[model samples]
Target: MPKLIKDGRVVDDQWQGEILQPEQIPESPAAPVAVQLEPGQGPATIPCALSNLGLVTIFFPAFTDGRCFSYARELRESGYTGEIRATGHFIRDQLFYLQRCGFNAFQFAEEVDLDACLASLSDFSESYQAAVDQPEPLFLRR
Candidate 1:
């Protein structure tokens, strides 16, 4: 089983859903439905059906591709209350920002030290801008 950082802890991924491509929806999906969103895919591609999914796994082909960061924010802005998991290629340094963008779960493609990654999540005690997790910007909070 794959390990993931969920809700601030490293644990075995309990997702039983099958992450299928946008067009591969089964007539009767036995398990919960999860969508695999690629780097170039628009967050709106699954807009109308956000509530129907059990999870939305956004793949970061590389750490340099920051598009997934926007996708996670957009998904949250669009009212996707379910889990928005960041998987593939992202580094631990981005974890804090990823969480600010509403990514509650993370699964790295590489073999990184989970403990170090978990610690990195708290690298900063606060953020300056408004985000999915923090609606009020720092100025507004002051």
Candidate 2:
């Protein structure tokens, strides 16, 4: 099984899902479930019909596309509390930023070093702007 950096550690990924036709969703997934949504597919992609999902993995076709950041935050702010993951083409340098955007887990492409990405999560001790992880911006604390 492929390992993932979840909650800051490497763990066996149990969630599974096949790319179903636009009309199909696993009626009752056996274990934890994951749903893949492309950036700009919009938050409604995770509508009530798939509320049982344990994870939502957002696809980043390119590092330059930042829509996924907002997608994850919107899911959080809208109250879908399951794990929000960023996968594909993302770089280790953006791990902190991704986490701040409400992504609790990350599944980078196999070419990236998982260990390095895990360490990147702690590369910074603080952030200044408001984010899902820290709703209050740094200036507000002054």
Candidate 3:
């Protein structure tokens, strides 16, 4: 089993279902399908049974790839209530920002320290602007 940062703690990835491509979703799946999306892809692109999805795993092909950030935010804004997992080459430094964009689960490489990455999630006390997790900006909150 692989471990991942989920809801601020390191936990085993409980997903036992196959992660399929958007077009590969079966017309009637036995379990809620988990989909893997490219950086620029959206959940709407899934061929069918969009509402039956349990998780959406977004891949960060490289540390410099920032396009996934927008896709995560877009998923939240579009009312996706399933898990938005961040997987691949993103650094621990980006965890805080990724959470702000609505990624609730993170799967780093095998060598990465889960403890250190969990700590980085709280690197900042607050944010100046509104985000998915924090709807009110600091200015408005005050």
Q: Estimate the Cα RMSD of every predicted model relative to the unseen true structure.
A: 2.1, 2.7, 1.7
lDDT of 1 by residue, 25-112 (tens): 6545555588888787866666336767788899999988988989999989988898889989999999999999999999999998
User: All models: lDDT?
Assistant: 0.85, 0.77, 0.86
Which structure among the candidates has the greatest lDDT? 3
Q: Which scores better on TM-score, 1 or 2?
A: 1
Using all chains and alpha carbons, the TM-scores for the candidates as numbered come to: 0.91, 0.84, 0.91
lDDT of model 1 at residue 19? 83
lDDT of 2 by residue, 30-141 (tens): 6555677776685675533445667788888998789999988888888778888787888888888899988988887856668767888987887799999889999998
Model 3 bad stretches (over 4 Å): 26-30
lDDT at residue 8 of model 2 (Cα atoms): 94
- Model 2, residue 131: displacement in angstroms? 0.9
Show the lowest summed lDDT stretch of 10 residues, model 3: 42-51
What global local distance difference test value does model 2 have?
0.77
Q: Which clashing pairs does model 1 show?
A: none
Q: How far is candidate 3 from the true structure (C-alpha RMSD, Å)?
A: 1.7
lDDT of 3 by residue, 50-100 (tens): 568899999888968888888888888877878989988889999999999
How much does candidate 2 score in TM-score? 0.84
